[model samples]
Target: MDINTICVHGSAHKTDYTGSVTVPIYQTATFAHLGVGQSTGYDYSRLQNPTREQLENVVAALEHGTDAIAFSTGMAAISAVMELFEAGDHIVISDDLYGGSHRLFHHISEKNGLTFTAVNTTDLLLIEKNIQPQSKAIFIETPSNPMMQITDIAEVAKIAKAHRLLLIVDNTFLSPYFQNPIDLGADIVMHSGTKYLGGHNDTLAGFAVTASNELSEKLRFIFKTVGACLSPFDSYLLIRGIKTLSIRMERQQENALKLAGWLAQHPKIKAVYYAGLPTHHGYEISKRQARGFGSMISFETDSEQTAHQVLERVKLILFAESLGGVETLITYPMLQTHADIPASEREAKGINERLLRLSVGLEASDDIIADLEQALR
Candidate 1:
């Protein structure tokens, strides 16, 4: 079936008993078994739930992975993935990932003896140079967060295979609709389902999907042990939101390109960082590897004052944290998304006071453009 058809009807949610088109919330914590030493596939909510499984199955199918595990939040999914490595193991990661993920590696994982080396993963050579003997995986965000830096996924996957290391791609920016990293050779694909998969920004969820059964086994063990599983209701919400993903992404991308073009031409703008723009350094790479340039765009103004003025003056576009919703959101990475990053490191990646990241929504292009125009003026 086509992807859009799968989005709405490809769910593994068939309860012939009730004949409900949607997956019903299996709210109970435990399920009654048929008999001793026998099961009906589900015994506990923590291990699995009917509703969550429906979402998981759909996600796995969408990403072309064998199995998937859903989580309470994006970080939880990543936390479970990190457990696949040992204490002394290491990994190479994108230098400009979300602040929360950076915190996970630098603070939690590093303290636990799992180390990381952050590099600009867009350059395959830089990633290759950073891989150590103990490096177990390559963890990267394509069209990386805030900066919109694009990585050549297939190239990096080759490097990972040559080194016998796992390749983990966070597909939150592109979602499964635009890019399936696994199809391009990713060992595992993760998502901050709170963003695009949830579409409405009303649910907090995460997903870790893998084509390799070995990785799936390890992740399943960690997911059950850590107990960061998504709730039945939230899983239902995600399933509902994902049904419109293809259409929503199409509209969001259209609005984003228009906004990025407008911002790039503005006199006060310093630079616009969107892979969709022909002038962007990663534009060609983005086109070669993915279906489309995603909606997330970051642009810088002449001064922090200008950024703050725009943030405060905007009436329609909300000044908020988080992205991939139906409504437009403007976030200041310096304080909002990437605040956990050190000032020196943040500025080094061009996420400075003057930088603003936009999560273009399903709003009308003219309204989104007009709001930015008046705010910038």
Candidate 2:
């Protein structure tokens, strides 16, 4: 079935005799049992809700995963994934990941005795070199946050298989409409449903999709145990948001490519980091593994002053944190997303004050480019 079809009808889990075209939000906290030892497939809202389950079903189908667990936020979903590793288990991760993931590993997970090594996953050799004897998994974010670095998912999956390690991919940037990491050998896929899946910037939600039933059972256990499940209303919003994901992503990518080309030619722009650009290091690899270049783009301005000026000057593009929404959002990694990392490390990764990330939206290409034009001036 086409992804667009799945996006539209995958959540059609028939729950009642209402014959409603849309999945109804099951708002109750608990279900009444017919008898002792009897069940309606759901006993409590914390464990599972019909609305959230439908949302998860759509995400799982989109990612080609056996199951997906929805959470209150992306961080909550990530936290549950981290719980899969025990104390003293080490994981090799992409160095240029979202700052919140970095904060979780450095401050929270490390304190719990889990170890991590951050390396450029694009370099397969470096990934192998950094793997410790106790390494349990490889977590990576292709088209990595802010920097837009792309790692070959198939190659990394080979490394993970050879070493008997779990492969987890953060598919937030590209979303399932553009890429399905599980099909490329990822054991699990993560999504910040608040972004592309939600389509609108109105809700907060997250998901952990498992490729295998074993992993699905494991993550689900941790999910219900942690109690960070998404609310029923938010689940409904996500479902509605996903219905338009195909169209939204298509428009967003079209605008992003136009904006990226314009930025690359601009005198004030030092460099544009977008996978769609032929000059990008991972352009070929991205083409081989994904369906689209996606809508996220990051560029470095000629100076910190120029970057600040653009952030303050943009009228159509919002100066805000978070990406993959209908509204175009420009973010400063140095202060907004990657601030948790130390200054030296952040600067080393080229996430300096001069760098700005752009989340192109469902706006006209000319209008989006014109907005940047005036801002760059």
Candidate 3:
């Protein structure tokens, strides 16, 4: 079936109860046993839930994966995957990553004995040089966090395969509608379903889908044991959010392109980082890999004070930490999202205080552009 059809009806079928067109929320925490040692498909909410199962299957099918596991938050899903690595194992990651991801790898994972090296994965040579003998996996976020940097998934996958390393790609920015990393040979594809997958700020969820059954089984075990499963109520909201993902993303992409173009021409703007822009370093690769350029955009202002001024002045866009919702959001990565990282390190990576990131929404492009124009003024 086409992606559009799958979006609306992939994992759900007309149920006998009320014959509702929409999938009804299965709110029970546990299911009763049919007989002694016999049971229904769901034993407990943490292990499984009908509503969450529908969401899992939908994401799995959408991403072309063998199976999918949903989590309470994006960080939880990431932690579960990282747990597969042993104490001595090393991880190679993109330098421009989500702030929370950096914290998890540099602080939390380090405490657990898992070492990591942050490198520019856009350059395969840099990645190859940094791979240690004990390196177990490579974690990457293409069109990375605030930088809009892109890495060739197929190229990285080839290098990972040669080194017998697992390849995990965070598909949050592009979402399943724009990019399917599994199709490009990535072993695992992950998303902060709180963002694009949920399509609203109402719920928080995360998910991981694996192309191979072996990897799926391993992740499933970790997820079940760790108990980071998403709740049934949020699962219902996520599924509903996904139904209009294509439409919402279309508007968002349109708005983002227009905004990036405008920012690039602005006098106060030093640089605009967006895959949609012709001059963006990642434009070609993003064009080749993704169905669209995506809604996230970032720009460097003349000064930190100016950046904050622009954010404060924008009336239509909310100044918030999260992204990929129907309403636009603006954030300072240096302070809001990546604040956990050391100042020197963040500055070195160009996550400066003068940088502003925007998650464009489904609002009118003209209104968004006008609001930004006045804010910049």
- Taking all chains together, each candidate's TM-score versus the true structure is 0.99, 0.99, 0.98
Q: List the residue pairs that clash in candidate 1.
A: none
For residues 1-377, what per-residue lDDT tens digits would candidate 3 score against the true structure?
A: 88888888867533237767777788888899999989776799989888888899999989999999999999999999998899999999999999999988888999999999999999999999999999999999998998989999999999999999999999999999999999998999989999999998999999999999999899988998999999989999999999998888888998898888888889999989999998988888988888999999988999988998998899998899899999999999998898988999899988998999999998998998888888988
Candidate with better lDDT, 2 vs 3: 2
Segments in model 2 whose C-alpha atoms lie over 4 Å from true places? none
Give candidate 1 regions above 4 Å deviation: none
Clash pairs of candidate 2?
none
Local accuracy by lDDT, each model: 0.93, 0.93, 0.91
**Candidate 2: RMSD over Cα atoms?**
0.8
What tens-digit string does per-residue lDDT give for candidate 2 at 106-151? 9999999999999999999999999889999999999899899999
lDDT of 1 by residue, 1-377 (tens): 78898899856556436777777888889989899899988999999998899899899989999998999999999999998889899999999999999999999999989999999999899999999999999999988998988899999999999999999999999998999999989999999999999999798999999978988898998888989999999999998998999999999999999999998999999999999999999999888888999899999999989999999999999999999999999999999889989999999999899999999999899999999999988
Q: What count of clashes does model 3 give?
A: 0
Model 1 lDDT on a 0 to 1 scale: 0.93
